[model samples]
Target: MEWSRRNIWCVILLTCLVFWVMLLVGLNAVA
Candidate 1:
């Protein structure tokens, strides 16, 4: 149970990072 919780958080963090990267890339392309 503990390990699963940690994994979930890791996945969430990674997803957020990826989303932020994509947003930056999109903004750069627009500019």
Candidate 2:
């Protein structure tokens, strides 16, 4: 699959969102 500009952006945004969600959940669990 070709990594078009839109596709790359989508993957980056999705990764960022997933990372943020996991970080928040981890902090909540620790606290």
Candidate 3:
């Protein structure tokens, strides 16, 4: 159960990181 929870958090963090990177890239392109 603990492992599953940890895995879910890791995936969420990774997804958020990717989203941030994309947002930065989009802003940079706009400016």
TM-score for each model? 0.95, 0.88, 0.90
| Model 1: residue 5 alpha-carbon error in angstroms | 0.1
lDDT of 3 at 28: 100
Tens digit per residue, CA lDDT, model 1, 1-31? 9999999999999999999999999999999
Q: How many angstroms is residue 11 displaced in model 2 relative to the true structure, after the best TM-score fit?
A: 0.1
| Model 3 per-residue lDDT at 18 | 100
Candidate 2 C-alpha error for residue 3, in Å: 7.5
Q: Give all candidate RMSDs, comma-separated.
A: 0.3, 2.7, 0.4
Candidate 2 has a TM-score of 0.88
Best by TM-score: 1
Prediction 3 global C-alpha lDDT: 1.00
lDDT of each: 1.00, 0.95, 1.00
Those runs of model 1 whose alpha carbons end farther than 4 Å from true positions after fitting are none
Ranking by TM-score: 1, 3, 2
